[model samples]
Target chain A: MNDKPLPETLLPLEVDGVSFRHRGQTLLDDVSLRLGHSGKTVIMGPNGAGKSLLMRLCHGLLSPSAGSIRWADGKAASDPDVRGRQAMVFQRPVLLRRSALSNIRYPLALRGMRRQQRTQRALDALRHFGLAELADRPARVLSGGEQQRLALARAWALQPRILFLDEPTSALDPAATKAVEDAVRAFHAKGTRIVMNTHDLGQARRLADDVLFLCRGRVLEHTPAGRFFDTPSTPEAAAFIRGELVW
Target chain B: MVDGNPFAKALELILGLDQVLVGIVTLSLQVSLTAVLTAALLGLPIGAAVALYRFPGRALVVTVLNALMGLPPVVAGLAVYLLLSRAGPLGSWGLLFTPTAMVIAQTMLVFPIIAALSRQVVEDLWEEYREQLQSLGASRLRAIPTLLWDARFSLLTGVLAGFGRASAEVGAVLIVGGNIDGVTRVMTTAIALETSKGNLPLALGLGIVLLFLVAMVNATAFLIGEGAKRRLG
Candidate 1:
């Protein structure tokens, strides 16, 4: 797999009639949406709206109880080659007890890469996030913002084709939030597909090419950024953007 | 008319026949050490596997091992005794009343404890660390071992505990070892036999030594546990 033509493979994603429920109450109900390549798709929804569940389903973490999710390149959700080309950052990053460089090198080692190549890749990743100074520090000891940055650095160092983030910066302080936003924009500049969920409308406007507005286990609309904010197609989405307690 | 205090007289007996007492304790040490090493080798990987994978029969294996964790020591001894008896399959080895038989019974007694605790430690790690590694493209097998390394401290403490339990228990060794002097007799059995024969001083001395041994094992375990906490913290 050559890195030719600068991001040539932009496989779209398809969700076909995916449905999930718990104890008779639906969490995601027959949801269908298409994710195009080379753009940020921000998932915006109110609390208890199942936005995170949708992200997990997309990233192949949760197996949907009904229907099927397929990639645009006709790969099934369980395919390792396809899944390996994607990465995710949770709301709170999980760092290993080892050093920062070791954390970055973990996935590479899992792929059976040789020791010297693994170390080089890890060093390159550390330098990218300005974590080179702390390469030997135990990853669990980094500050909240630094950990999230390191998590992003590790994910992106693999050059994954798609990155799914579940409110990655929702827990950070304002200063840290800016750092994470800067990282996200850098990845965006690299033409990596970004699918993210956030409650902050300001963040959505800054990051999204299109908005996937969700409410109560349903997709309210798939509207462009400008129209989604100014003239939401649904009453629920408009209320959510305005912080009017859609729930 | 026997004695004013059995423990007091037992101490005298232990001091008088110091060689016998020493021999018993030495044999106990050898057998228990061997059993624990064997248990760790056999048990840790199986425990880790059950904790990290979700295949068919996984739950059943965990449940059975958990049930075996409380297996009575004498019952384990009896089970092993039967297997190694003349009429049983393993009788050809002539191991029915030997130190080897005692080791096997003790292994049976504490193998479950090591395995069960190891499973608990590995499972806790799997629950917490699986998602992060999976997101990083770690295969299930690789991710599980990494999780085990994260919980290395707990696994170490588990082994120490297994050692203590195996070395200190009497019921299993008493049944399978036959308590033959200079051949199968161990510290626990000698302590019991000397007491029954109204040997108070030797029994008291051995009892004190046994207590000291337990204290040392626990002290070592505590220090190692603290060291692990510092490294991982």
Candidate 2:
């Protein structure tokens, strides 16, 4: 019964040096950084800089080819119970051919939650996303924004402690993007640790409490949002912040 | 004069309620239904496994099932005939010339068709469903149910095709079951036996019943297939 919560959004977790390879080409190369358990951690990198792979590695979807990624709570991220408490929202949300309500209930079903509990939780989540009106609609037929909101609602219903989003707004229009951003900010307000990847600088500025900047599979800087945006210490960070071609 | 006689006699046999003809047609439907069920029991799981799992001999199993799809009805009849004979391993069951023998032969005829077609259905499903299911943290077994539901319409067509194949086949049941006059004769066998015995009216009547059955199964399958395509929302 080690239920003692850590102080100051404790992220006593350790990632000594983690890297990933696909077909002899490196995807993430010896990237190491640290973050607290709460607030938003934005991963910003140019295309092919391995931001998506890094997020997957953090979420335990893809195993790193080298080094270690250990959670400080002494639970392996791959454990079902631990993984159950973590949910990832993909760039292109994959939806089941079911009603919107059922999509929200799916993760609960996996955890073997009670039927009544699942129904109430799903309804609550849908209402939060302003999707209670579309509860019985087929999730596959929803618009891009609606589907993304449903994805968020489903993830929220899981009560995830660590939420990973891989460019959730990249596929959305500006208005739809604003809607999803508001949902992310609301989740962050409730103390969920957010790790998201994005190329939208304005969005990163709006949502990021800290930044993890990467270039060519390596971490160039892991800095506070205010300082990193004002005067980047590293050359790569400076070039990236200035909107210069880093790829 | 003989053409009118044959036509009138066949109509009387059908409209006047011939008991033997009616009994044979009913037995035919019952046996084919049971055979299709048995084929599904044997073939659908095998097809799904071959479609989903990547074991050592999966390719060989699929190849054999595909080759068996064209197995001659007479050859299947001969094989079942030998297996149910007095000297065979299953002879203790005393199944020969009984309705059971006809069912076994017909099941064999339909098994390969169901297996081969269902393999196609399940393979396509795997391509479409595997990643989505896996991402949802669904296990291999649970993922299969989702995949199966997605391709259920295709599996439905496979089953109807199997039933059609089983009901229309003659050589297997005739050779294996011997199509005794009262006990084992079905629509196809009774039609064959009556035709050879110059009972043109009875044979023609059974033929009409068969033509009606084949048309019905095909029409139902096509309708369901089209409906599935239209209702994908």
Candidate 3:
């Protein structure tokens, strides 16, 4: 039901020479990549590859130690509208302790939407996510799958131009993972750009329009989904594709 | 020193609503409530600031607060006494030997209790909500009220704890209040005066009332906390 026309700004998400360091040790080296305005771009990397950190940097939740991240035609990511136009869901869904209804309403409230409109919007989101019956329940008491669905509903209700998800289904069972995959597909269908991180190669293959393979904080390969699986350019990515440790 | 059992006589005073007993109880509530309310007004912001922001000397501020939580009531009373004394810096206000001075002393006694406890509560809630709220576009300062509201049940316990401390304290109020008969005496001070004068029944009666008052406050806080936990969480 996303009839609302997309915003005019088509500034591709650009990460130019971004690096992050903590305690005098580099976590992400001079990594750079550009993300298109649509479809699922799954970030696949082994443990400690800085996948989540990079997603955070892209979402404007964290700043890089060096280099720049810009979105929407050179628009500063800190711009209120820019920030408002994107949302992120972490590995563990962070729902408010309020009712499921209120969890979605909170971000709408933050957007300063009027009570009547936001309430209806939130209710609609709950219905859309098959959570309408549980709307009155405390969000924290929901099942993991339900909580993840609620988190997605909360982000989707914001009508974000882009959604960043970090290992969204890492902790889910098969059925729950499938449910989450369906929701992610719905977001993609509605034309919301999806940039996600996952350790699940099969899930990545299923949902990814493209793959950004990272190894030890470096982008080993960023290629189309079909090509990445068939012929990864770097040995690190090839080894990772074969389920072997790169380092 | 009494001809009759003091406990029975004390119960009679309470049941009969003795004027002196009532006066002591009323004054005790007034002074302690004012003190706790003032302390909360000052403490909540200080507690929130310490929890939500990082700065130089933060560790020292927290250390002093933790230490102040256990500050002896007598020392606080003495400090307030000097401040309100004729030759003291605040002497011109003429607050010494007045109820105002006792309120000042109790506020000083419990401000740290409220601040320290609230800082802990708010800090824990902030830790849980920080990244989520920041991603939602709430700056650290903007998130304080939200975090405070969400942690309100815990913060209410801190206030109740402050009230308990202020109400039960005798040393601070006694020094600055002077326990003036029919003037500035509160429950704790009146009980002390009565005991010193060998009026065991009256003192014991006031002590009973003080204990009951504290129980009621703590029970009410507990019930509200449970209700909030059930309703909000």
Best by lDDT: 3
What C-alpha lDDT do the candidate models reach, one value each? 0.83, 0.81, 0.87
lDDT of 2 at B87: 89
What does the interface RMSD come to for each candidate? 1.6, 2.7, 1.7
- CAPRI band of model 1? medium
What does DockQ give for each predicted structure?
Answer: 0.50, 0.30, 0.56
Quality of model 3 by C-alpha lDDT: 0.87
Q: Which candidate is the best by TM-score?
A: 3
Interface RMSD of 2: 2.7
The alpha-carbon lDDT assigned to residue A69 of candidate 2 equals 79
lDDT by residue (tens digit), candidate 3, B156-186: 8888989999999999999999989877888
The best-first sequence of candidates by TM-score reads 3, 1, 2
Candidate 3 per-residue lDDT over residues A1-247, each given as its tens digit: 2337776584489999999999998999999999986779999989999999999888887899999998876887788878888888888987776899988988888888888888899999899999999999988788999999999989878988888899989899999899889989998898889999999999999999999988888888999999999998888888888999765
* Candidate 2: tens digits of C-alpha lDDT, residues A117-189: 8999999999999999999887877999999999999888876777889999999999989988998988888
Candidate 1 shows a clash count of 16
**CA RMSD, predictions in order:** 3.5, 4.1, 2.5
Q: How far is candidate 2 from the true structure (C-alpha RMSD, Å)?
A: 4.1
